[model samples]
Target chain A: SQQGEEDPQALSIQEGENATMNCSYKTSINNLQWYRQNSGRGLVHLILIRSNEREKHSGRLRVTLDTSKKSSSLLITASRAADTASYFCATDASRLWDDMRFGAGTRLTVKP
Target chain B: DTEVTQTPKHLVMGMTNKKSLKCEQHMGHRAMYWYKQKAKKPPELMFVYSYEKLSINESVPSRFSPECPNSSLLNLHLHALQPEDSALYLCASSLPGQGPSGNTIYFGEGSWLTVV
Candidate 1:
């Protein structure tokens, strides 16, 4: 079963625009991580935000975790054409340590 | 090396033909995983190996066999696969225990399998 679900199944924007994707999970999670995939290829680690922390930033990526609402969001600042890809959020909870479920993912396309 | 490598970037096999997907990682990660992904779907956990031991099975079909020869290698054996079984076979690795701080997974390019 999938623990996390990403909203806005697809998003398209210009090269300089910002891309924001949201994810919601069911259970109390220890941490949530985001990944990027090009086409049908494997995933690439983007950023990780823990339950204890409310928000985090890495380069142009900003991740915010809202445990109260059981949701998280990934913000890509100044998106580029190369940033166009499928973004997925994975949730790792307490009970299921080894079982990390991924969301359906959000497809973001940055038009150049 | 810090990356995971998989062999046979693409594979085509018949319904009755048997083939195996190989994955290797030199990051010394204690845990390895096999995930099956269909088009427009998220990767599904098939099997997990921790410290050379099969930890989680996810109730995957018996036709899909997983092997961990050593700490640095993981293999998925496929046999009698159906047409719907054709999908991307991805290999990922992470640190054994938990916590996103120390346990971040790295994935390979994946093996695209087409069953005909």
Candidate 2:
């Protein structure tokens, strides 16, 4: 089953703008990881934030986790046309490796 | 390559056809998983194999059988599948040694299966 849900099923932005997408889950999570999937392709790992950490960043991406709300957000600063893709957030429990579930995803289309 | 590889980028089969999806990884990982996704839904776990042994099965239908030939290869056999079963099948692998604190999975270029 899917453990999380991402809001704004679709987001369109102009290049050089910032794109923000949010995800909310239902259960306690050990860690949350974000991924990017291009049209008709596999997924690529973007970033992973542990339960102890509140915020993390990688390149042009920033991720924040709020355990109380069971929600997380991914912010892409200075978005580019190449950043156009579907983003998914996956939650993994602290128990086992297979105890992970992914959210629906948010489609971001960045136009130049 | 730092990636999981799945064979047959695209597949089309009829309701009575029998086919198989293959996945390979050379990342020296101990665990592999199979996930199925519909048009706009998220990937759902179907099976998980750890240390070359089937460890997790999500009560998936018996018509779908999974096989692990070796530590580097996995296969999913499809038989008597419904048209609704057509979707993107993904394969992922991860080193499940560090527990949850460091659990990360790498995915392959999923195989798009269409059952007509």
Model 2 chain B is weakest, by summed lDDT over 10 consecutive residues, at: B95-104
Give per-model CA RMSD. 1.1, 1.1
Candidate 2 lDDT over residue span B20-109, tens digit each: 999999999889999998877778989999999998898999889999999999999999899999999999998877665767889999
True lDDT of residue B21, candidate 2? 98
**What DockQ do you compute for every candidate structure?**
0.62, 0.70
Question: Which clashing pairs does model 2 show?
Answer: none
Query: Which lDDT value does model 1 have at A85?
Result: 93
Candidate 1 regions off by >4 Å?
B100-102
C-alpha lDDT (0 to 100) for residue B66 of candidate 1 = 96
Candidate 1 residue lDDT tens string, A60-95:
999999999999999999999999999999987665
What is candidate 2's lDDT per residue for A22-110, written digit by digit as tens? 99998887889999999878888999988788999999999999999999999999999999999999987557656668999999999
